[model samples]
Target: MKLSSRRKAIAPATRPAAVKAGKCPICGKPQDAGYRPFCSKRCSDIDLGRWLGGRYAVPGEPVSTRTEEDDEE
Candidate 1:
């Protein structure tokens, strides 16, 4: 292999590049690599709590609860 061709293959790996960091979706803060998408543990926990508490609900058809009368019928 030619030296030029070898350099071309290795050039990509040696380049110093700027990485664009993403903001947290929950808190509008710079995203942390540890938590990811959330700035801190608290924000991550808040997001989870929202999911568990049904605060973050998906748009869908409302489900009707079966009544005792409906069950008897």
Candidate 2:
């Protein structure tokens, strides 16, 4: 058997699990390869706008704004 053919036969067995191609998170439409988890440029932009507008936030302890000088004063 040819070396190339053997490699091809084994490739599928060694490959990782295929990613699920599901609906877009933004609009519930089929995802596009170009936009990925989003369906279209419009959906992708909408997601971005939400992040930039502070609609999405990561929860954490509030950061202190005062520095050493402020503490001393």
Candidate 3:
């Protein structure tokens, strides 16, 4: 009868059919809420590993490191 209780009884609007039916980017399976955009923890871990291992990189200008020896010169 209260406003808060009425709101709680209503279910959230569902996503569009395309979004709801979209496949996981990692393994081409339907995505799960727990691991959104990916199918499972294994796929999630694989993605994380790729990032940690530098397999995924952003495009940027190369940076040169200046060492103490270079400073001496």
Candidate 4:
């Protein structure tokens, strides 16, 4: 009985969780059917709040200034 309960609890957690365009990045909550992307209105609003709250950000890459033969050429 304990094993069954544990299995049930762990079943959903074991499912594939991804950061797709329409899926929630913070949690594995499915996109809402009405929200058309988020699993629910609350999740969708939360995502928006995070964005508005500046929780998400774009990462920058390091730039290379010198060429391999800069001195020679």
Candidate 5:
């Protein structure tokens, strides 16, 4: 095969388009590569705070603390 033909076939496979990053969830701003989904450290901290502060909770049924033995007693 000619060098030019081989080059054309490999070029597309080697080169890929840049991936677009999504906006920050905490704030509506473009995401930074360093902070990932968050735009900055501030936003990242805010998200962490929310989780630690019990603001974000998982949905589930309440667990029963009492047993049948407790009722008998």
Candidate 6:
């Protein structure tokens, strides 16, 4: 119920290591069904969308609107 600091830090290490040890990547709680890392089709697709969508990105600056052509452009 109570994890020591060491255990808390090591907790994350355990899941990925399951993969490193040849376990499922998705869910990380199921058997690998030839998904190679991911445990299921759903999680695999979710991760793919995250990477492709630019979700992890810096905040974009707002465009200035002082130019006369700004409305046309």
Best by TM-score: 2
Residues 11-67, candidate 3, lDDT per residue (tens digit)?
Answer: 977769857687677788888888877889888898788887685565566787977
Evaluate all candidate structures by whole-model CA lDDT and list the values in order. Answer: 0.76, 0.78, 0.79, 0.66, 0.79, 0.64
Task: List where candidate 4 sits over 4 angstroms from the true fold.
Answer: 1-22, 55-73
- Which residue segments of model 5 deviate by more than 4 Å? 1-20, 55-73
Off by over 4 Å in 6: 1-26, 55-73
Candidate 1: deviation at residue 60, Å? 18
TM value for model 6: 0.40
Query: What is the overall TM-score of model 4 with all chains considered together?
Result: 0.37
Ranking by lDDT: 3, 5, 2, 1, 4, 6
CA RMSD of all predictions: 9.4, 9.1, 10.0, 9.9, 8.7, 8.2
After the best TM-score superposition of candidate 1, give how far the Cα of residue 63 lies from its true spot, in angstroms: 18
Q: Per-residue alpha-carbon lDDT of model 2 for 1-73, expressed as tens digits? A: 5767766565455334234656688988889999988999999999898887685565667899878888774
Q: Candidate 1 lDDT, tens digit per residue, 1-73?
A: 5767766565455334322566777878898889987899989999898887685566577888978788883
- State model 6's lDDT: 0.64
**Candidate 6 residues 1-73, lDDT tens each?**
4556665565444566554566455556565566656667777787687677677664588977688777685
Arranged by TM-score, best first: 2, 5, 1, 3, 6, 4
lDDT, residue 11, model 5: 45
Model 2: lDDT equals 0.78
Please write out the lDDT profile of model 4 over residues 1-73, one tens digit for every residue: 3666765565454434354445655466666668756677777788788787675555456878878788684
**Residue 62 lDDT in candidate 1:** 80
TM-score per prediction, in order, is 0.46, 0.47, 0.45, 0.37, 0.46, 0.40
Clashing pairs for model 5 are none
Q: Lowest summed-lDDT stretch of 10 residues in model 1?
A: 10-19
